[model samples]
Target: MTFLETLLDPFQYQFFIKGLVAALLAGGLCGLIGVFITLRGMSYIGHGLSHAIFGGYAAAPLLGIPIVLGAGLWGLASALAINAVTRRHRIGADAAIGVVTTASFALGVALLTKFGNKGPAFDSLLFGSINGVSIGDLLLLGGVFLGTIAIFTVLYRQLLFSTFDPEVAKVSGVNVGLMDTILMVVLSMSILATLSIIGVTLVAATLVIPPVVARMLTDSFGRMLWIATALGTAAGAVGMYLSYQLEIPSGTTIVLVNAAVFLVVLLLKGAKGLGRTAGLDDHTDASATGLVTASAPTRA
Candidate 1:
């Protein structure tokens, strides 16, 4: 096949087309929410919620219900429970995440074992295959992508204020508590949105690595959002293509691509820093800003 034919070959198939759309939507949405996730230091929350959703997935089949709905509810409940536990008690957020997530995951594993072959295959749920995406899945992913954009657009200022400066935002009447809840809700839904495309095991990486890489490249939040989204979208498309050609797992390929990108950016950033240290790049600007620091007040 010619180079152009090789590139266009995947697009000739309906399943491949649907998979690409799903990947782009899931990746972009994850990238958008990931900015806030990274800034707020809630990476663990993403991982925890993804695992917690497995509980609902394992139970939904037994109840004759849709797995997505069950998993979404479970993910949301986990997010809220973690928020409530950390806020109402003296315990740290990570501790609450550990307690809630592990228990939920264990329940999922036990249920799966008890009802072997009744539910969807454990391998499919844990490590997704993008080629399995259907029209219905594409529609759901589109709805989620649109909804996320609307929410982010309407609440941009409040969300940004609360994320970077919660105390100041509260003083300015931003309703820090409510904003935090909103963030959690969005985070939960984002995890659910990516479940079918990336699965529980690797979804959190999609929600994290892109934003971290974007953060290394830019100081401005707006730029970071754009860069992250672009990076994620590109990674998803490229990874899917590579996976198809290489006959590898889609979720694993996508995550590995994301990680590779992050590593490359990290090395580049380190190199730049070293150049600055050696006074080899006097024209280099100062490090980017807007990332959360240890001194910043964080909401549990």
Candidate 2:
């Protein structure tokens, strides 16, 4: 069917609409938070948090509580825990993430096994099956996305300053520590957004891959957010479709597609950089900018 035909298709259901809304909201939030994650060089931290939350997910089904809520709470706690340990010691953030997430998730598995042997259901949380999403899940996802956006908007200048130049932000009284804590919280929420919807294994990719691809396409952070969001939305939808039509796993297929997109971007960017040195595509990038102009955000 054509684009118009598809829109008019009666096969369109509320579930599909909800899924799309969830994906868009999740994608935008991830793209925004990912800028900080990518900039801070903490992709592994994102991975650790997503995995650590599995313990909560395992407990949720047995307790009959909100799975996302359970996971988000634990994820946030993990984030704060990482921040605390990394701050008071020589252990870098990455090392802290490695230690905490793996241990917590392992403990979660052991505890879950002891509870009622409900391990397979817990596996679904890790693998993700959007086919099972409900209205409640959509609402929860939306709430997290909006709350994160509002918090970031309120601290826009301070966060940006702290991210780019923490010492200067501290000297200028920007509350750098608070911003760091908030950013980590947002990052945890981003993982929660995708944990059950896209599964834990792919959650980090949904946050990192699109942003990494978006980076090569533009230099401006603003533009990068837009491009990454677009890529994320596309990846989610197309990946789901391929999974359905091909009868493959939806979450894994989408993640693989997103990874492929990232590989392509890396190759293109790498070739360009190599060409620049080899004088193949040797030329100045007119797109480079010293600051954000009104037109500068077009790519984002």
The global C-alpha lDDT for each of the candidates, from Candidate 1 onward, is 0.79, 0.70
RMSD of 2: 6.1
Candidate 1 lDDT over residue span 103-127, tens digit each: 9999999988888646556776787
lDDT of 2 by residue, 7-49 (tens): 4452376655565566556656666677667656676787789
Q: Where is model 2 more than 4 Å wrong at Cα?
A: 1-17, 61-65, 117-120, 273-300
RMSD list, candidates in order: 5.4, 6.1
**Which stretches in model 1 have alpha-carbon errors above 4 Å?**
1-4, 271-300
Please give the lDDT score for candidate 1: 0.79
Return the top candidate by TM-score: 1
- Reference-based lDDT, residue 202, model 2: 70
Work out how many backbone clashes candidate 2 has: 2
